[model samples]
Target: GGEGGPNAGGERERRRGGRKDESDWWTRFQNDFPWDEKTTRNVVIGFAGMASAFLYFYFRETGKEVSWKDFVNNYLARGLVDRLEVVNKQYVRVIPVHGSYLWFNIGSVETFERNLELAQQEMGLDSTHRVPVIYGSKSDGTFLMSILPTLLLVGSLLFTMRQGPMAGGRGGGRGNPFSMGESKAKIMKDNIDVRFKDVAGCEEAKLEILEFVNFLKNPRQYQDLGAKIPKGAVLSGPPGTGKTLLAKATAGEANVPFITVNGSEFQEMFVGVGPARVRDMFAMARKNAPCILFIDEIDAVGRKRGRGNFGGQSEQENTLNQLLVEMDGFNTSTNVVVLAGTNRPDILDPALMRPGRFDRQIYIGPPDIKGRASIFKVHLRPLKLDSSIDSEALARKLAALTPGFTGADIANVCNEAALIAARYLNESIIVKHFEQAIERVIGGLEKKTQVLQAVEKTTVAYHEAGHAVVGWYLEHADPLLKVSIIPRGKGLGYAQYLPKEQHLFTREQLFDRMCMMLGGRVAEQVFFGKITTGAQDDLRKVTQSAYAQVVQFGMSEVVGQVSFELPRQGEMVMEKPYSEPTAQLIDQEVRSLIDAAFQRTHQLITEKRDVVEKVGRRLLEKEVLDKADILELLGPRPYEEKSTYEEFVEGTGAMEEDTSFPEGLRNWNKDQGMEESPQEQQRKQCLNTVSHA
Candidate 1:
C-alpha cells in the first residue's frame, strides 16, 4: 500500500536474495573493484571512511547534526562522500557505495583534483575542502623528480673543478698548466746571469753585439736621424766560438726580454704546428716590444728550401715560411729584432740572409794570439794559478799547438790544467801543469811505463834524435823543445818543437821543415843499415809538405807558378794539378829534392856520427831529452863559435877557448883584446904576404 513501507521493502529484498545469491553478489563486487590494478585504492577508501566516521561522531557530540544532504554536498562531494564521474549519456555521477559505480568512467587523479579545485573555487567552497599541490609528484605518482637534474648539476661542478679554466669544464685535455702559454717573449730572469764579461775569446763578435745592445737601448737616436737599425744579425762561425754567448750578452746589455729557442724546436711532427708556433712566438715578441729573439743553430730550420729532396711535406720548410713572414712580412716592425747563430752559414737559405731579414752577418772565428791570451785570463780567474805563470806565453804555445781550436778549446785546456793540478795536490796551477795539460790535449797522455824490446827502444831513440839533429841544422826549422823515446799515445817516440809564432810560411821554410821530417828515415837508413816502418809518420809529413810545396806554394820550378787549390773531393788523385807529362816531371823533381835532402841528412849524421850516437844512447836510457842535452851532444853551433875567418884562414888555427865569454858565445880567446892578439897579427901579416905574392 505505500509501496510497501521501508521495512516491508527490506524484507522483500532479503527474501529475493538467498545465501548463494548473496555470496555471488559479494564476489562480483570484489571483482568490479579492479584490485590488481588499484591495490591501494581499497585501503585508501577504508581509511577515509573510518576518518569521516570519527569526525562525524565528534562533531555530532558537539551539537552539530551531520545532515545527510549537507554531508553529500560537503563531505561526500567535498568531505565524506565519494562518487565516480563517467562520460556516459550526460556525465553521470554514481556513488561508490553501490556496485553500479564500477561502470562509471573515471579520470586520472590529477585531472579529477584539478577539476574539483576549479569547481570548488568557482563555487567559493571552504578552504578546508581544497586540495594541496605536491612539488615533484605528478599524475603518475613519481617522487623526487629533481634527482636526475641534481645529479647532472653536481657532475658538471666536479668536471669544472678538475679541468681548469681553459678547458670548457671538461677533464683531460691539452690545457696549459700555469697559464704561461700566453706570456710575452721573456727569458727566465734568474738564469740570465751570463754577462759580457763571462764570455771570452770573441772580441770582434763582442764589439758587434755591443753596438746592437746600444741600438736596442736607444733606438730613437738612430731612428730620429733617419737611420734604421739592423733587423737581425747572423753570427757565423765554427762551433764553440761563442756566437750564442755573444747573443745572450747582447740581451743582457740591452736589459730587454730575451726569447731563446733552437731552430729545431720549431719543427714538429704536425706540419702546420710549426707555422702556428712560429706565429705565436712572433706575436709574443711583438707584444714584448724591444726584445731580442735568439735562434740558435738556425740552419736546422732555415736550410736552403727546395734544394734537397727531403720530401715536399717538410715541417722545417713550413717553419721557414713562418719565420720569413714574421721577420720581414706584413707585420714586421722595428720593435723586435732577431738574432740567429749558426756554424754552417753556407747551407742556410738565402732568404734568411737577405738585406731586410738578417742585415748583418758577423763572423766569430778562432781566437788570435791576443784573444787567446785574454780568454786564458778570463778562464783562469777562478783557478788558483801561480803568479809566475805567463798567460801570454801559455797562449802563444796553445795557439801554435791548436791550429783550429776555438774559444771553447782554450777553456777546456784551462779546465784540464786544473784537473792536473788537483791530481798532484798542488796548491796552485804552475807552468808545468799547463804544459802537461797541453800535452794531454794535443798528443794524449804519456805511457812512460810501456815496455819495449831493446831493438824497438833503439829505433825510437834514433828516430827522435834524427828529428832533433835535423831541426838543429836546418836554419828555418822550429827549435826543438824535447825528444822522447818513451811511447806516447800512438807514437813509439816523439819530437816536440817550439813552434814559431808565424802563421804564414815561406817556401824555403816549408822545404827545410820537410827535410827535417825526412831526417828520421835517413837516420834509420844510416844507422840500422835498413829502413823500418818507424818513419811512417815522417814519410806522411814529408810527402804532404813536398806536395804542398809543389802544388800549393808553387815552389817546384817544373810546376812554375801553378796553383792547384784542389777541391776537397779531388785530394786523392795521383797525377793532380798537371798534365800527364807534367806529372812525370813533377814526380822526378820531387824524388830528386827528397833524395838530395836525405843525402845531406846522411852526410851531416856521418860528420857528427859520434854526437848522434851519444844523443840517441842517452835518449834510450832516460827516454827523454831536453834541448840542453841535444846541444851538449851536438856541440855549439857554428854561429855560437867566436873564431874569426882570418885566424882559421891563415892556418894559425889558434884554438879559441873561452868558457866565460857570454851566455850565447861558446869560443873566444880570453887574452885577445880589442887590440889584435899575436896570432891574429901574424894571421893578418900572412894575409898581406899572400896578397903581395
Candidate 2:
C-alpha cells in the first residue's frame, strides 16, 4: 500500500510527520516561554530569590529556646503573648507583642493545644484575648543547607586543581602545585627611578651597560651596520660596589621594559621547577620584546658544574644549563639584553661566562678618591647640612676618609650623618656629625655603656696607645688617625688609621704593617709582664698577612718569587696544590715572617715605651684622642706621609657665595617618608666588622 500511488505516498508522508520525534523538555520550554526582556528579567529574579532563600535558611537564627513553664509565665500570664507557631510539630514557638520571640519542645499538636486551652481558661482569658496559633513545616531547603558546605568544598577543590600548576598553561606539570614554575621576575614598564646620573662611582660599568640600552633603543641601527648585539653582560665585584645600580641605570635610561629576577628564584623544592621557570622567564622576556632581563647574585645557580655538586644538588646545574641555552638562543632582533650580577663570579660556570653566552664581563671594583668624591656629592644633596659646609670640599674630605669605600659606603656615610644629627636634636647635620658617622661606619657603634675594671681599662688604653706609637714612627706604616679606649662593637678599644690609597706594596711596607698589627701584644708583654688575649684579633690579622705575603704575594725569600694561588676563605677545596714538603716550607715561611715582625714590633715598643705610657695615661684621662693630641704627646710622625685633606682643599681658589646645597631631585620623593634607596639600605645592611686586612 505505501509503495502504490499518490494516496499511499501522501498517507506515508502524513504518518512520518505524525511520528516525527518531539523536542526535549528544555527545548520545548525555551520555545514556549516568552523571550522578551521582562520574561528574562523574571527568570533571573526567580533564581536570585531562590539563592537568597537558601542562604537565609542556612544562616538565620530562629527564636531562642525556653522551658514551657518560663514561656507561660513570661508571656502568656503577662498578657504579652502575640502568637504561637508549631514548627514541624516538634517544637512550639512563642511570639511576644513587644519583645523577642521564644520556642520550646512540645509533645504533640493535640497535647499542646489541650494544654494551651487549659492554661488560658485557668488564667480566665476570654476567647478574643487568647493567643493565636499557627502551623507550618520547616523549609525543605534545610536539607540542602546541611550539604551546602560539602558542595562548596568540592567545587573549590575542582577550581583550584583547574588553576594549579598541574593544570595551568605552558609550564604545567601533572604532580605540581599552583604556579610553581611561574616566573617570579619583577617587570617594570620603563618606570625605574635610577639613571646614569644617579649612579656616580661605577662610571666604567655604567658606560658599558649603556651600550645595551643603545642597542635596545636603536636595534636597527646596530643591525644595519652588520653588528651583533651582545647576548648578556655579567657585572662582577665585591658586595655593595654598585653592580645592581649599574643594571638599574641601564634599565632606567632605556625606554624598553625591564625585568629582574634573583637567581635563587629559579630553584625550587621540586626537581624540574628550576628549568621550567627558566623557560618561562625567557618566554616572558621574548613576549615583551626589546626588554632587559637582570638576574642578581647569579652565582647561586651558576656555580662551576663539576666541583660543588655535593649532596646531589644537581638542580642548580640544570637551572644553569637552561639559563645558558636561553641566553645563547636569543635572536639578535629580539632586542632582549640579559644582565647578571654576582660577587663570586670566579665560581660561575665557564660556559656561562663564555663570549657567546654572557658576551661581556664588567668588573666594578671599589671607587678611588675621585670616584668616591663624586659618589659623596650624589648622596649629600638630600641631607640638611650646615651653612658653612662646602659640598665640594666635603666630598673630597669624605673620599679621603673612606679610602676603599664603594658608592654604597658613601651613601651610608651621608645617611648615618643625618641620623646622628637627628639623635642629637640638631636642626642640621654638621661636619662633626659626619666625622662621627665615619667612625661609626668604620669602627662599629661605640658602646659607652660597657664598663671596664680599672685594670682592664688600663690594659685597653696601653694596647691602643701601642698601636698608635708603632704606626706613628714606622716609615712604611699608614698614618694614625684616632685611638680610643671606649669599648666599641666586640672590642675593648679601637684604633683607626688613615690607610693610604695605594695599589702596590713593597716588602718593607707589608713588613711594617705586620709590625704595627703586632704592636698591641708586644706592648702588653713588655708593660704587664704577661701577654693577654687583648691582641687575639691583631694576631689573626697578622697571621693572615704573613701567609698572604709568603704564599699569595710571593714576598718570602725562601718561597721564591712565584705566587701560588692558595685556597681562599669560603672555598670548599680540601686539597692543597703543593706537596706536603712544600706546604711545610710555606708554613715555615709564614712563621718566620710573623716572628720577625713580632721582634721588630717588640723592639719598637721598648724604644717608645715612654711614648706608649704617655699616650695611655692621656687616653685614660680623655677616653679619646685625635692626631693633634697624639702630636702634642709625642713630638711628630717621624715618617713622611701625604696629608689626606690636601687634595680636597687645593686648586679650588674661593668658596661660592651660595651657602645652601640645592634640593636633590623631584623624583626622589620625600613625601612618602623614604630617606634612602633600596641600594643604600642594602649597603647599610652589608656593613660588617672592620677588617684590618
Candidate 3:
C-alpha cells in the first residue's frame, strides 16, 4: 500500500510539473515581450504573411468586373458557354470556357434569377442547353483582407509599447513624441563653468544680478532684514552686450539647479501647445526650487498683446499670459529666481514688465573705454603673447582704439587677432595683428585684390588726405590716427579717427566735427575739380549731425527747445506737432547750418592746400599712413584735450571690480599657449591615454 501510494503521488507531482513546463512558452514570451529577437521576427513574418494573403485575394485582376448588360449581351446571348457563380447574393461571376472570368453586380437574388431565366428563353435555349447558373454565398473574406493592414499596424504599435526606447525615464524625455506639450528646457545641476569675473563691460548690471546670487546662497539674510527676494529681473540691452552672460554668471555663482529655455521654444502651430509648454516649464522650475530660470530672447513672446493680434487668439499671447500668471504664482519662499534677456524691452507687454513680475529692469549698453579695457583683459588671456607685452597697457591701448565696442566685439577682436597671427604662421600674436583685427571688425575684410585704376586711386588719396589735414588743424575736431588708400569694404579708402571720449558737446565741437566730415568732399572738389560717391558715408554723418543740432539737440533758434524724434526712412508719421510754417523754418535752419559748415570746410581745405598736397602724395606713395606719420609731418593738435584712455576710467566705478582670468588662462604657457598648471597637464596626459575605444 505504501509503495502504491508513493508511486501514485510521484506520478501526480510529475504531471503537475509537466503542466508548468508546457506554460513556460507564454511566460517567457510575456517577460521578453517585443524585445526578443525571435519573437519579433515571428511577428514580422506573420504580418507579412497576412499582408500577402490580403493582397493576393483583394488585388487579383484575372476576374475583372463588368456591367450587367455587358455580361448578358456578350456572354449568355452569344452562347460562349459559361457557368455563373453568384457571390454574397450581391454579384454574379461568369466563368467563360475560352477566356478569363467576368463578374457583374446584381440588385436582388430573386430579380437576378428571373432575369437569367428570361435571358435563356430569349436566346431560345432549352433547359438542358441553358447556361448553368450556380447559387452560393461568398463570405466577407475580401473585406476583412482590405482592412487587415491597418489592424496589423495598430497591433505592432501596441507590441512596441511593451518595451520601447521612446518611453524614457520621464515618460518620454523633454518634448517627448508621446507628450507634445512637455517642456524642452535644458536643465543643469549647477554644472556651468562661467563665473561673474568672466563677464565684463556690464558691471552695473552685474551688481544687480549678484544680489540674486546672494539671495539664493543665503535667503535668511534678506528675510531677516524684512526684505522680499525680487520676483524676477529682465536684462535688456543692445545685441552683443553682456546680458546673457550675466545671467549665466548668476546661475554659476548660486550653485543650484539652472533651467534655461528660449522664448521662441514656447511658440508652436498648435493652439494650446505654447500655453501647455509654459505651464510644464514653470512646473519643472518649481520641481527644482532654488534654481535660476533663464528665458533668452524673451521679446519673441513678450511683445504687447492685441497691438497686432487681428482676429483669432495668438499662441504667443497665450504663452505670455501663462508666463505672467506663472510669475505671479511664485511663492515668496520658493527660491526659483526668474531672469530674462532681451534686446527689445520697449515692445514687451506692460504686464510682464510690471513691478510684481519683473521688479528690476537692467540696461546694458555698449561699454565705455574703461569697460572695454576690462572686457579686453578677459578675452586676451588665452592667446600666446610675448613676455615683453604689458597686459594692462595693451588693454588700455585697445580700449582707446575701439571707441564704442561692446563686450562681444572685444572678444571677437581678440580671437580674430589670434587667427591673423596663425595665418602668417607667427609664434605669438603681435600689436600689428591686433590692429589688423580691429580694422577687419570695423571696416570688414581688406579687398587687396580689388585693384583700382590710377585716377580712382589718386582721387581716393586726396579725398582721405583732406580729412586728415582738416581734423589735424581744427581745435575741436577728433584726432586722425591713420589714412589708407587701399580699398577696404565698399570704400576706396578709409581714414581712422580717434574720436574724443566725450558725449556732452558745445556748438563749436559739433561744427568742427561737421567740417571734418565734409573735408573729404571739399578736398575732392578742390583738387579733382569734382566729387565722387566716396563721400556718401561722410555726407550722411554730416546730415545726421546737422539734423541732430536742429531737431534733437534743440540748437536751432527756430525750433526753440522742442526736440522731436526723427522719423526713420520707412516709418510713417500722421501729423507734425508744429505747424507747416514752423516746419519750413526748421528746414531753412537745417539748410543754413549745412551751407555754413560746407563753406567753413571749403575755406579750411583751401588754406591747408599745401599740407593736403604733401599728405596726399605720401598716401599715394605709401598706400597707408599712421598717427606717427601724421604727427611727424604736421605736428600734434593745439587744443588741450583729455587722453582717451585715462578719462573714461578715472572716476567710473569699473576699475574697482576684479576682472581676473580663470585658472587655465591666468598662467598660460609663455611659448605654446599651453596650460602651465600641473593639474591641467595631468588631466591632459590622462586624456591622451584614452584610445578611441
lDDT digits (tens) for residues 456-569 of candidate 3 = 889999999999998888899877768898888888898887777777999889999999999999999999899899899998998899988998899987779888888877
Off by over 4 Å in 3: 1-57, 62-175, 568-579, 642-644, 647-693
Which is better, 1 or 2, measured by TM-score? 2
Location of the lowest summed lDDT over 10 successive residues in candidate 1:
659-668
**TM-score of every model?**
0.59, 0.71, 0.76
lDDT of 2 by residue, 51-75 (tens): 7686876755476988888887877
- The total number of steric clashes, by the backbone 3 Å criterion, in model 2 comes to 0
By TM-score, rank the candidates, best first: 3, 2, 1
- Give the whole-model CA lDDT for all candidates, comma-separated: 0.66, 0.81, 0.82
Candidate 2 stretches greater than 4 Å from native: 1-177, 307-313, 645-693
TM-score of 3: 0.76
